[model samples]
Target chain A: MVKKYTKFIFFLFLIILISSVSYAKPHKQLSDYNFFKDIKNQIPRDETVPYKIANPLFSDYSYKFRFVHMPLNTAAEYSYNNVFNFPIGTTIIKTFAYPIDERDLDKGFQLLETRLLIKNKNGWEPLSYIWNNEQTNAFLKYTGHTFNVSWISNNGQEKYVRYRAPNVNQCKTCHEINNKIQPIGPKGRNMNINFVYPSGEANQIDFWHDRKLLNNIPTPLKRNPAIWDDAKYGINERARSYLDANCAHCHQKGASASNSGFYLNIDENNSSILGIYKTPVAAGRGSGGLKYIIDPGNPADSILLYRMLSTDPGVMMPELSRNLQHEEAIPLIREWISQLK
Target chain B: MKINKKIIYFMVIIFISNFSYGKIIIEPGPNAYDRIQEALILAEPYENIHLSSGYYEIEDGLSLDIDNVTLSGDGLDKTILSFKNQKSGAEGLLVTSNGVTLSDFAVEDTIGDAIVVKKANGIRFLRVRVEWTDGPKSSNGAYGLYPVESKDVLIDSCIAIGASDAGIYVGQSERIKVINSEAKFNVAGIEIENSYFAEVTNNIAHHNTGGILIFDLPNLPQQGGHDILVKNNKVLNNDTPNFAPEGNIVGKTPNGTGIMVMANEKVILEENYISGNATAGILVVSYLDEYEDDNYNPLPNKIFIRNNQLNNNGFEVDKVRAEPIALLTKNKAPEIIWDGVTSFPEWIGLSKQQRLILGPNKTKDRKTDMINLNLMTYALLPWFHKTKEDYDDYIGEGISLTEVNFKTKW
Candidate 1:
């Protein structure tokens, strides 16, 4: 009896040791997760769905390829107003790439980095992987990386950007809310649009619900945020959508920059909280000698427009993941601010 | 010992803790940015990360989010972290976790704030130096040693300089202690804004716009800052031009002012060497802005000023916010000036304990006086304004605020 009890204890200890070792080490290579059917071509594997968001956050104008992979037996809980809460073992992947030449469609692009947010028992854990020079595989990177790339713009202009991949803690700058790291994209309104999937064209939330990857989504989900460049939507809606994607992640209530008292979320309705004639509290040099955050009819005097056009470290909005100003979006924002009453 | 569930749990905790806690030493090199950040991300509770003495050229902002971590360096002058080419992130170094001790290092010339610790508890910054290297420019980052929305903050023996905003700024925090520090060439040196229960003593603030200011602003999560003690500090020669960028609240601070308290309550200012400030030695005023928050009170109430050596102040009145008061006082602004702005109709029902009190102020045998520029009357009816220079009306005992102590937990 004593020998049997000792054997059982030894076996338990061995199992515990193995589990601890496995928990300490996560997947080191991007390919280890195997969510791609064709890694180079960016094809999704089983239960891995490609998705798109309206008014996507800008990263020096890098084109983002996004996908979500869920565990076999689980699904994400639907949220009406906020981001969809995913289950444990869900992995949201995003690959940032810069085209060799934006004027030429057939030309190839350079994949810079792949960021992953994996939800486990503890909470959402963010990881970043940097692609190699050969563009074959990506390895895990904890600290950030910066590299220079030049690409011809769609309008036949030469553009150069020093791209930045956020470090682990920098990821929390936007993703962490109320002391918990969570997904920032895939809000209900942002994902309520139609997508051209491999199977067919359908609304993204409906597609997820049909595939059994989303649970308890209410019927007649009819909210749609604007695709910032789409001219069919009103300019105010488009500009608010853009600000919601780029700046609201940190500027909203209970987020990272709540101390500033400037809330730019889509739901924020108060004009003062939206930074109209709002005085800066701690914006030292970022103020740019401007008076109000949004000086109506004067984009040049608006601090919001000034920060959007600025590429300086402290003066820029969104504050991370981009070093260059988004020229395509700045004019739209400037136009919107000029029209503000 | 018999095998029990408690024993098993204890053994498991010990094993897991043994695998995580330790010391990590990193030397500066081309890869120090990544390696240092990686160590900060992976550090466990109670871990000590020692950065060896060398100059590190960091390209991006570094952050640490783990609790109970100690990030130390060789010395403030030895281990230098320079962010001259920082292309991304808001601040140079951001600390978001609780119980973090950052000591013995120097951070220089980032595009934004040098060091910002936010939403933390029990944070300590010791023997650290943050400088812009370019003296007092409008383009320099805001706060040097900035701690906001924190609790039990202790900043000791630090040196901050050349920031466009305040050098040592503690905002929206509680139970604070800022001791033995030196701040120079910043807009507002050593500021405590919208915070509570702070003891600021034994510091030297010089060559800045306003030395040692206590302010409370509206539209913030924390409001009604009160119960602060500013004692035993040297505030002198803060005649640097106000180099803060426009639209910042601190940009309104007049050059050459010493120890201004605005829109706060239950403040005690005592036992400080204040001199050589061209503006007033101490300015107590109300919040002068349009605010929409209904829960906000924008008045300085229950202030006690006593036992301070004041000299050579109010000689050259600043052209900014202090000009109107200087014009009213005929260019000889008193050592202490109070914008006597009070709530209407409510002031008629207040006791002596609820009013501004003035004890005996020890001066340098100079003609040091106190003035109340009836600003409330001026705002209501400018034609009927009266400036009163009397210390007898405010002579009374004020409430005894508890001193801020952090010896028990921090």
Candidate 2:
């Protein structure tokens, strides 16, 4: 009886070892974290771990679901106002999807494609994995593909947009800084907000700390970075934060639009660089008859507002991934500018 | 052993023609996009990337960062590269390499610029047609056939249209020639800004906000534009409404203006047909009239205009479009208006012969502000077109500048 029990335990151990080895690299088509299935487990397999953010860059009303998987025993360095220094081999995944009815949050969504930013030896490499129509699996999309996505808005209106999945080079358009590829979000301030993680609701920083995935972060953190849409923050703070995340990626110093002499970052103390009574450099019809980028105390005459409200391909701000204007944010920005005095 | 010297020489010629210089033809299909990108990437120096006649819809910007590579299509109209659905990046095709020639193709409807050649030298655009499919709209891309911050460039036999900014623009570069091109229906039809030693000749600029603009703008990485030649070009009827984005410099250009020069040294305009514009045929202004640009020269020095036919100007000036311009000037503006603004403290230091040189031109019956500085309200506003009290004071012809020889520079 003793020999029989020992033999049975040895066989089970052998089976577990073999399965774990196979799970390391499932296939080239599928991600290492499996499909969007299991996410919160100690060794998440088949199940997906769900995550959310306080604010996200608008993408034509398309909702996003993000997940992260870290190799065990690895930790990310702590940085302020910048992305967490993640270890090599960490994979950050975001799936672009849309709800059946945008007015109803409870409505189920149709998954489109998943973008992965895998941290490699050089840096994070961005790739797109398109989900099949049947919602079973996703395959690596080397070349970009486009498809029609239809949805219902809160007003009970039918809407549709031709969604374009960005190709690999397009991914580098925003991710690149000073010729180096980096992540746009996941900054310390963006992640400091409370999140409904698997172990109930808590600050994401604490959650990451408890999971031993982050370096030494002080208790209560260094600074509270305001999420742009939160009403608790001041309007100036919120508006500047929104512009920093969306526009500064290309408009700041040493960026693609550096020649334009515009800076929308949080650290830019100069009000003029934030587009106060500033003349445009090469904005042809994008000006919309507005004399300055911002006419202090007059939001109606500001070129900033003109570009925000416009949908014309050349006249729009934050050039891509959004066809519709962020109507809700525009008013808040207008109010912020009106009170600039 | 002097056996068959003629046969050996013929074999040598065949070998040289076959392998050392060869062409690779790429076909169109499902795999063509990736195949072409790979060919562009894997192409070696002195290699030719030839594409068969077909229409291609590319989603991402195509970039070439290698040297001595030539990309050619079957013909300009036969091969079309469209970037209407670009996901990211700015241009349809971006180049950061030297010794690259893009020829015999049409790039249309890009999200941003059609082709942007930057920070490289010895680039040439031959028999290329860059256009926006939609007619002149404010939402069109900024530039077509753009080359910035490169040297020894040639843009020959090209057609550009429907750009929000300049149809054909060369900026912050040196030793360039833009000849035998047609630019129309854009903001500034053909603009050479902040560059030195450029010859723009034998081009047609029509129906734009301002045809043929040479400006030295402030707050850019490059400044102090000088030594440009504008000759043998038809700058006609550029009365299109300004559709440029509000912040760009050209966006402020009034409709129906032709051949604008601002803050440059040593420019010669000669032998060109300048007609049918409403505002003015030749407009020279100081940079101080526009923005608060510090440490930059704002004077127009050693300019020579000769042997040009100017007619029918100020006929259909769009006064309501740019009301500030109309508020300062009359309905019949002028054939040549020089905003006589000079901040030189030593007023008596320079002779009259050292100023702008204008000669050998004729215009219709008109009494206008040739040196109009009536709008110079210093310390009042940052008006781009400043007013000068002595706007029509100076009359003596200055010394003619030496003609820039392109054959020697190139």
Candidate 3:
């Protein structure tokens, strides 16, 4: 009997050892902030819901993958600003990476970092997690990082950049509306496009409504701003929408560019304010020697087009975020301006 | 417990010794921004915050609330703080402390003003370079070295380029000096607006829409700026198209303008080389000509133009000039122009000394100083300048006014 008891105790000890190893949290956790274990390995299999964007923002030519999660019965309120007011317990995840090759997805990609914006009891909190080089678990970091990323461009040229990882407060730069941290994209207009769900490819708005992830669901959104790169939309609409998404955030009232008299928001209807024969206020060399902001029917003479085509730090529009000209969109803008008699 | 106390005491002593032995040095890496921010927070009076030479890609702009601190970098060419991908922070660096000095660094590609020193005292920007890098984009930062609503400010030996607004702008600041600087590819190269007791000297302002603007705007916290001296500056070319957004005061400035003074008093312009501007050189106008300001003084008073080599201006004149200004100066656009509208309806007994006094000084090798002096009954209407009058009657003799200088330490 004593020998039998000894064997049972040994079995119990073995179970304890296995349990401790499985639940081991090697990296430290921040107070009241939830972080994923790893970008590739430890994303919750069934708990977290993964989503994708249509017409993603160019991050110096980097690929992005997104995911979302919320507590049971929680939903988001849709607003016209294109930002949804997410309920407490909602979590949004965005991962920036580069696919090793543009042609293949199965070979896997290099995952750099993942950012989590969580809505707790107080307000939305932004956090950053940097992945380890060995593909291990990521750790929460207050300081941002930079890594050299190489990618094969559409023209088959090898491109490289030192990709920057944003710090916690940096997220608020784009996320702010009225000195408050808020989401920029993922609004009804931006998300009206199709997404591949568990069932099949369907409109993201319909999918969200069906899943009860959104609140105050309109049968159809009042207005849907089209994706700037989509050919389905008219050229004028596309250009207007593109300027709205990229420039209007800061160019609007009370934002940084408010001091400037020009407004580039999509909703702006004034033709002169829309830069038709409207002389530049302070273009400097941004004019590229052009006389006006936009010379109707003359795309080459338009300062807007000149600034868009330039990569000079002293003379480019939308002053930041791009070193290379959008090779495809330039022609569309040129055509739009050329046809505008 | 006694042993633990002794150990803690030793560590504290070492930590204190570390701070005294060496100043806070910040290098570009993960959390480098945070470390710099924390160092600013923890720094004592008269401490140095030195950033090493490298490219620092920060996500947000930085701010300092510390007093009496010196913030320096390895060098302007070597240390580049880029906010090219910044998401938030209105400016690259915002300082609201008293007696802050920044030097030998380049702030590149910010979304807003590159460096804004607001409501501070004795602020200095020495040997700093502020640039957009991509050049001349309307969406570039507004001001490069902006010191607004501050007192006793000095911006010396700085290089500013690629701003949508003024490159080296000092607004609403008292007792300020901007000297030995280079400003190019901006709207207004160096603008001193609504500030009292200011001096701008030995600076190069070129390739901008308007080189060197001294303005007194309305509806600002500070107004009625007087006693300004602009001397020994090279104001050249500046024929770039006006890229400022509509509705801004600078937006109305014609391309290729040199030394424009609007709605101020006791301004002395002397010993400056003003040339190659497409518009008239040394344009002095009243605020009453532009936007309406009830509380602000619309008339420019005690403006003394002395010893300036004004030539080659009005080569490519702006047709959009207010009808009065355009009609008054039609042929070859005079070397100097003065809009004769004061605040009052009538200038019944105003002499050349009471109004604008031109040239007790030199105009290069030219004998006659061409002047377009107007005596408009009403300042608001553009047609008043078009009215048939003998503007040449007021131009026979050019007088002089009292010269002002920086009496206070600035």
Candidate 4:
């Protein structure tokens, strides 16, 4: 009986030693583990209830996104495989997993849970990704279990970095292609999860419809008294600010365009002097001999569209150091160019 | 803290030294001359006296014996050193010491020479202009720039006009160079006499009685003027309709030569655009009698005249006679015999046989008729009769009336 008890204690000691060693190793290589295998199986096949995101510290945040419906024949008639041609309301919800340092993982999860609120018809709906039997939020299956959230202060004095699902490097590698200037949330090609209701209306769609925040959202019919004020987030201001931050760093005077003599300063109100909205006669960058980058009322012919769609390092947008292609920002830019009549 | 205090003390010493060696400024007033004299007495070597931009009219010439000093002004146009009423026999500014530089000022109507540098070496005149009110023929004033017995001299970006003698006269000087300067409306734009190893390049000698002259005349003790180079100069509009008094003949100095090198050995005249003159573009004659025996003889050697473009835009001969002549009769005694006969050299006229050997007729046939006999006799006769006694004996035979019907073209 004494020998049997001693053997049992030795077994317990062996198990404890193995568990502690596993936990002590750095988590940099943990991404190789299939953490999403079980969660992906729970995602619904129906397009309306496509997926939900969950993490170890949060509950489920229900969301679904899809391409706009089009006639089969009409889709087949278009030869070019461009995703930008889809109807204006088309969207997508992507999901991924990121392994972070254990010390930061707790804070990352807390920040994500606190900021995960959905703006519904009535008001903002406070929500969290549902946690499963493994103590992880179920919504992580659809919107990635890990995410990085960062913001530069309005005055540009400081930058704050927090991780809800992923650390700064893990999220920024794909999201911050042209640095943190690009939107990483899901409303666009960013990390923000887009939640849709059963009636197929986008959450926060009021900013585009009731608030008139978007200038280029086409309406089926004209209604009396516009839904929202026109001053907020007008398409011109949005597109101009976006291009200035993303493209003008190297294109303005004394930068890379020092040889080309083409300056694109965002503050310049004179379109004639800025050389925008006009064909670049001798742009060294090959965008298929395109005369202009922003053709009025015709985004298909613009070279800017070609550049944004290209994954080729020789022809990519921003021309340097961009990782993931900004899928949503490209379409918005295309729509802005299309509406430039 | 100890190291910091030591560094502070070191920096203080450096600052104090710099303050003690700062530039000194000189302002002109009633006591301006007195101040300048005191500065000259106390100036250390490598010091500069910067004169403010103003007019300085002196009753007497200012002389300096300071070495390695510069008397500079704010600018040439603003700094006026007027000696209009000064009766001083010395120059307006005289420097006897070496390494003296004067710049950015003007000297006008000095009673004597405008500037005189004696026994000075490495003297530079930068943008300093000297002029006289009387025309180029005026005998009251002489030697606008007289640098005698000096060495290693440079006269750059300066202008001199209306001198009784040569506008820029460098006598008995060595290793001198004059560049990017102008001598216009003067008796002689530039005259380098008894100078060795000199270069006169990139200058404009225009509208003067005589353009550029390199003469080796006898009478001076210091000889040996050789290896002089005159290149890339524009000598134009020198056919001024005024002569330099009775004995002093002028008006482009005959043959309409833009550059005249009389008795200069090893002289290189290259890449010069000499145009708009009445005579040949370049005249190289050996005036052996003009100089005393001991004076420099710059002749009897190689002279390279190459790449010169000549245009005969000179005035008519009848117009040449209208110029006045100012003869220097002070040292020139009256001739004991005033003979009506004058010897005209055969080389003066364009004979058909002579024209064939002289290559081609550069001047048109009408130019021969325009030759002023009186001016020619005055310029050549005195020296000609003095040198050649047969010129007095058989002078009448040389003056025969001959006409040739050959049409010449310039």
Candidate achieving the largest lDDT: 1
Docking class of 4: incorrect
Q: What is the TM-score of chain B alone in each candidate?
A: 0.93, 0.86, 0.87, 0.70
TM values, all candidates: 0.94, 0.76, 0.63, 0.41
Fnat per candidate: 0.72, 0.43, 0.04, 0.00
Top-TM-score candidate index: 1
Best by DockQ: 1
Q: Model 4, which residues run further than 4 Å from truth?
A: A1-341, B1-22, B133-140, B241-257, B288-300, B313-410
TM-score of 1: 0.94
- Of the two candidates 2 and 4, the one with more favorable DockQ, higher being better, is 2
Sorted by lDDT (best first), the order is 1, 2, 3, 4
Better TM-score candidate (1, 4): 1
Q: Could you tally the backbone clashes for each prediction?
A: 0, 31, 23, 46
* TM-score for the B chain of model 4: 0.70
What local distance difference test score does each model get? 0.88, 0.75, 0.72, 0.49
**What DockQ does predicted model 4 obtain?**
0.00
State the TM-score, rounded to 2 decimals, of chain A in model 1.
0.92
Instruction: Report the C-alpha displacement of residue A228, candidate 1, in angstroms.
Output: 2.1
Residues B184-214, candidate 4: write the lDDT tens digits. 7776778887678788889998877667887
* TM-score for candidate 3, residues paired by index: 0.63
Query: Taking the tens digit of each residue's C-alpha lDDT, what string does model 2 give over B100-176?
Result: 99999999998888898876678889999999988898778899988987787799999999999999998887888
